[model samples]
Target: MTVAPRIAIDAMGGDDGLPVMIEGAARALGEDPALRFLLVGDEAALAAALSARPALAAATEIRAAADVIAGSDKPSQAIRRARTSSMGLAIDAVKGGAADAAVSGGNTGALMAMAKLALRTMSGIDRPALAALLPTLGDNDLVMLDLGANTECDANNLVEFAVMGAAYARAVMGLAAPRVRLLNIGVEELKGTDEVRDAAALLRGATDLPLRFDGFIEADRLGRGEADVIVSDGFTGNIALKSVEGTARFITDLLRRAFTSSLRSKAGFVLSRPAFHMLKTHLDPNNHNGAVFLGLNGVVVKSHGGADAGGVANAIGVAAKLVRADIARRIADDLAHFRAGPRTAVAAK
Candidate 1:
């Protein structure tokens, strides 16, 4: 029998740390018997949580780590001071080969900082981008990257993002020749700032790439399934991503209120219950629980700060899938090819 990959989870990292993460770990272990978990955090609290589950007693192990990185602490200082913070300890497990991958639901900036310092980046990847899967109108989801990892990116950096995003789409999403686009203010060739223009030129010239480059896509068209992978600077990408999430929540809440307005409406809601549930699954942030810091030497999945047990479970699942797929190695191979060419710059006209 094949042994399941061991995943190290930061049990004291997120807002709902001990309860939610512990619950999620137990649930994941139950679903996959071969799965092994290295729970890193306050040993006493973790032991208390796991004590109820006798079945998981054998599959799960706890690592004692005293410090907890606060969300407000500076990333560098936190990393230095909290040698045993849940996030730091989880990364250490990966480094020590005690875990195949690490998942954490904590401060985004701190996570990135710890990951880069701990794992480093692959060759040719100047910086790693936080790539997230966003729901689209079609059956397949869209991949967006640099989601607040590096706010100020150059043209070459954007091109690198395109390459990494493409690999993620193909490997993770199982897309063949995934359609790629640059996120911009307008769809015109000459739109936004000089950086966009230069990046467009670079991508246009690189038709020999394995993936399909579909040119610029406006932020408004993101959800319309125009492209499988969208690339942009971290600042803009973060804003666009958060806006979509906020809007989805707002619309869902409005619909819920409308459906429960009166007896007639309530009857209609019951009739359409299945469809509503489907919609909820598609739009729910909990369902799309993990974001990968792509281009890193090791797999590091960042979960939502507010993630519950379901979300944490989903994150562990994502980490396992990514490790099994050998995503980091695939990315390294793709980057080697891209960088082997005559390094071309997106020149300003």
Candidate 2:
């Protein structure tokens, strides 16, 4: 019989700490009887949470550790000082073959640092990028890469990101021959800085890739279903992602206030409850909490710091799917293919 893949969760990492993480782990296990979790954190809190659910208690194995990395701690300093922190322990679990993958909602910088230091990067990958799936106007979700991970990227790095993002989209979104786009100031090839223009030229000449190069994409056209995978520098990608999140929250709050303003509106809200719920689910960050750090040797998922139990559960589900798909291995294979092809001649400025 095939053994079920084990997931290492940082129970003491997120804002809500062990309680919410444990709840999320329990929920995930409840969904799949074969799923096993390795919870890394304070022994007492983890035991208490698991003990509440007898079945989950049996499914989970706890790794007792003392330290907890705070969000405010410096990534380098925290990584060195807190060797036994939940996040560090989770990475160790994956490294030591105790788990197939790991999930964390703690310090982003610290998590990235630990992952790089512990798991390292796949061949030909200059840096591992944080890639997320965003809801788009199209039928399929758009995979955006380098989301707050690498602030400054070069032409080759962007090309590498494009390849990785395309592979992820094809595997996760089930899109054959996924359309790839480079996020830029304008859709034209001549627009943006020398870096983007150079990257666009390189992508255009990458005829060996399975992805369809769709040229440049503007930020405004991101939600309009322009491309299946959007690649950009971390600075731009993070700003765009946060802006969309803030806008989504503002719109939801406004709708809530409007719906509760009067009896008639409240009655309408009751009648439209199903539709409202669907819309909320479509826009909810919790439903899409998992952001994979692509180009790594092993699957490492980073959830939102303020994620709830549902979000954490969804992140775990994402990690499971990634592990089943062998996403890292696939990415490495694709990168190797791209590198083996004739090097594209750099376009003249």
Candidate 3:
């Protein structure tokens, strides 16, 4: 018999609050009947919301939480309310082994801070990184890491991100060995800062790693799917991610305007409706909604704050999938091998 994966949800964390979270959980439960939830939020509001979601209600158990960490709250402010806040309690459920993983559509900084404090780093991992899947030209999505979790990262950090990111690709992308690359201004080893070059040199020689360490990738080629995993410091990764999102939106809007500009264009759009619908589905943010904090002892998935029910369901799905796949163990094993194999080689040479 397969054991059901349990997820702890920060019900009041996102812009849509409990209603969307509940609806999302309901949708997820409908798809995965064996799934269960530990919903952390205000008891009265959650109960009221869950009444309409009988399937979700049956699979959920509300854990009362009085406070919510607001979107504007700083990490320092959020840590103080860790015990009382909905997001914090949801994380706690994972720490306490009450749930397999925690999913939240909340303040990213706060969630990272609280999760780090609560779960700490797995042995040998210095810092946790936020990783997510991005649609690429390939049949499979590519994994990118340090997505605003650590604004600054050193060479060692970048190498660690590669190991962790590759493990993530293995778990989610179903790749046996993902091709990893360092995101840089240029592909040449001579380009980029000391940190990136150093990280690249290390990855290039780390024969023990299961992943293929491609030298570098420029931001312009990210969607080409040339690499399976792209590693970057949070500052660079966040900017690149936003740039891609903006470009997608711009193209979508341009198509909309073009289709409405003339009867001829409208007729063309009608003829190509199926292709356009496929494009829309492929580019939709909801399909890739979860961003995971890797290197933590427990799994923590971040949902986009403004995501709708479909997006929220996708995030929950990601969390549940990671739990079932034992992603934490995979990362730990890979990190252990990485640390033991090339501890002195990267920096020494």
Best by lDDT: 3
- Where does the lowest 10-residue lDDT sum fall in candidate 3? 338-347
Q: Candidate 1, which ten residues in sequence have the lowest lDDT sum? A: 340-349
lDDT of each: 0.84, 0.87, 0.91
- Write the residue-wise lDDT of candidate 2 on 1-349 in tens digits: 1247699999888888888888888888877677899999889888877778899888889999899899999998877944688899899888888998999999999999998888988888998899998998789888998898999998888998998998888878888789999888888667998778888888888778889999998888888887999999999899989989899999999999999999999999999999998998898889888999998888899988888899999889888878877888778887777777665345233
* Residue 294 C-alpha lDDT in model 2: 91
* Model 1 steric clash total: 0
Ranking by lDDT: 3, 2, 1
TM-score of 3: 0.95
Q: How well is each residue in 24-117 modelled by candidate 3, as lDDT tens digits?
A: 9988888889999999999999998888778888899999999999999999999999999999999999999899899999999999999999
- RMSD over all Cα atoms, model 3: 1.7
RMSD of 2: 2.1
Clashes of each: 0, 0, 0
Compared with the true structure, the alpha-carbon lDDT of candidate 1 equals 0.84
Better of 1 and 2 by TM-score: 2
Q: Write the per-residue lDDT of candidate 1 for residues 115-172, one digit (tens) a residue.
A: 8888888877888999988888987889899899999998878888998889888877
For all predictions, the C-alpha RMSD in Å is 2.4, 2.1, 1.7
